[model samples]
Target: MTRYWVRAFLSGLALSAATAMLTVTASADKLFGAMEKAYVTNPTLNAARAGQRATDELVPQALSGWRPTISVFGEVSRTRSSKEGVPIITPDGPDVDSVAINNATSGNVSIQLSQPLFRGFGTVNQTKSAEARVDAGKQNLLATEQQVLFDVVQAYMDVYAGRQYVVLRRQDVSALEAQVKAARDRFAVGEITRTDVAQAQARLAESQSFLVNAQTDLARAVASYVQMVGQEPGKLSYPKVVSIPNSLKMALDVAGEINPQLLAQAFVEVARNSDISVAFSNLLPSADLVASAAGSDPDFAQSKDRSSAVQVGAQLTIPLYEAGAVYSQVRQAKQLASQSRIQVIEVARAVRQAVASSWNAYVGLAQIIKNTRTQVSAAQLALNGVQQEYQAGTRTTLDVLDAQRDLVQAQVLQVTAERNRVVSGYQLLAAIGHLTAVEVGLKVPIYDPDANYKRVRNKWIGTDVKTVE
Candidate 1:
């Protein structure tokens, strides 16, 4: 009967294991699916894209310098004299005490257009500077996307790792409960002391406590996953490690070429160089073609006495001096350009260091994962031997318990190493500037910054209206 019962117990355990594996397989959600959702729905990423669109307007604002500015004016006024009536001269004669000349109502309408002929090449450089800034904004948007995606990857790993920990903890609790029951049965049958049963009970209690702590950690991980990916985590599919750069040197090279932050700073340096050109241009002369037409009525209610005039001329402005502010600005711009150049170098070095560190971490985690898996396997074998020895009365119950504890620890370490491996790969990808939706091959619409820029850059009308949302 005992042999049959033992066979039934082993069969039940095997069935439970099979069921758990099937459940995990059936309920799995791919990591890329979560990443795609985050890329599309993360508010931070969307806001960064919107901010880049806003920065796109700078190009059009600078382009406005090449376009003519038109303005219209109309005014009505009552003119009155406080002094006594004085003599006023008409076209034909002079009149004394002329109240008509002292008081009158007048109105005028005028339209003027001014086109910038030249601004010492300042307009050209300003537009170029704006273009550089727009490029920088694009890089910044890319950096934000990388950052959000990295966060999503981290959260996903956290939830998965936490779930694994919970599973191990539950296994520990179940194993200890069985041990406690076995110890109790042995003591009642005069096979073991009450002290053995007490030890088993103590271990079971500790395992239960650990299980509760693991549950708490899993809850926190779920919350973080929801916050990052915009939804609750389901059963996670097997993690996929991203392909890495061939070598550390290649990784550093890639980062220098495409790391979004470094690229953004590079564009910033370019814009600052253009700024210096704009500042120097301020010292040179500017020319504008100005034209105006006006109509005036002396008395709207009286005679048809109206006059019209038209004027067209070119105006040149020479900046002789302005309290040394222009020269000061030029000097400041040069200093700023120098600073930006220094920052570019600094950022490059920083990128290299980040890539190196991330590469080392990824390599270390890979090794740790391999070692931890081996450790789990060895520990499981040892625990099985210890259990067999305890059944044969050749090993103490405490020895079996210690072996079980070691196995649990090894399993936890294996899970943690696996989590770290995936997360480190993501870190490496981000350090090399490939952690973007497009780079990751996510099936989502890419936001184009130039679309809004093109929509508003050549917009000549609606000066007071906004054309892009």
Candidate 2:
């Protein structure tokens, strides 16, 4: 009867092991889909989009300099006067009959238009500067997106690693429980002392505590995922492990030169250069067509008399000196451009270092996992041999317990190494700047890069407001 029950128990354990080996889908939502929803629905990313749009408005504002400006203006005035009727009398006699008269006067109103003819190419340079800024803002938006994608990848990795820890700890707890039961059985049969059972019980309790800690880690990982991805992970799962890229060769080739953040910083230099052009143009003469028209008499005191005429002429302005303000600005912009170039170099060096280290770490951890798996298998074999010896009265219960502990420790290490391998793969991908919504296979809607620019540029301008190159 005991043999029959033992066979049934062993069969049940085998089925459980088989179930664990299969892909468990605790989450109903696909990984990429959840990430997509997070990308489009995240408030933080939306705010970034808003900032980009705000930056795009500068293009039209600068372009306005090349277009005509019109305005309608008016003003009113009242005056008080004193008069005497006896014009032929002496000044003292006329003062005896003086009287005060109050008169109210009014205003004039007309539309005024002034159009730019030439600005020493200042306006052109300004338009180019705005264009560069728009490019920078667009790239900044991309950087924000890259950061969000990195957060998602990190959250996914955390959950995956945490789940592995939980599963391995549970296995350890189960093995220790079995050992304790075996020790108790041996004690009752006079094959071992009470001390053996006590030791087994103590180890089992420690393993159970470790399981609780694993649960805590799982909870924290879930919270971080929710914070980053903007929703509670109901069907959270990491079905596919992130794989390392071909090798460090591909990574080193692309790390700093192509990383999104670094690429954006490079464009910043272009923007600063554009600013220098704008500043240089400020030192030159500017000319515009100044015109005015109105229906009015020369004397406002005239009654019901209105005359209208138009005048047009060029208004020129030349900058003589400004306490070295313009030169100072040019110097500042040039220095900043130089600083940006240096930053690109610095970032490139940093990324190169990270790529080398992360790649090696990833490959190293992968090898560690393979070796640790072998260790686990060997420890299991040793534990089995010791168990057989205990049954044959050639091994103490203490010896069997130590072998079981070794096996559990080896299994834990193997699980950890596997988790680390996947996490390191994520870190390496992020370091390369290829981690984005589209790159990660998220099905999210892409925010258009030129959306705001097009919206502002495609608007009303005067008939002659062609792009005067």
Candidate topping lDDT: 1
Residue-wise lDDT of candidate 1 within 364-424, one digit each (tens)?
Answer: 9888989998999999999999999999999988998999999999999999888888888
Model 1 residue 51 CA deviation in Å: 0.5
What does candidate 1 score in Cα RMSD to the true structure?
A: 11.4
Off by over 4 Å in 2: 1-28, 77-105, 177-202, 234-238, 241-245, 295-302, 305-309, 390-401, 458-469
Q: Model 2, 2-42: lDDT tens per residue? A: 99999998797557545643644574655676568668876
Please list all clashing residue pairs in model 1, or write none if there are none.
none
Q: What TM-score do all the candidates reach, one by one?
A: 0.84, 0.78
Q: How large is the C-alpha RMSD of every model relative to the true structure?
A: 11.4, 11.9
Q: What is the C-alpha lDDT of each candidate?
A: 0.88, 0.76
Q: Show how many residue pairs clash in every candidate, following the order shown.
A: 0, 1
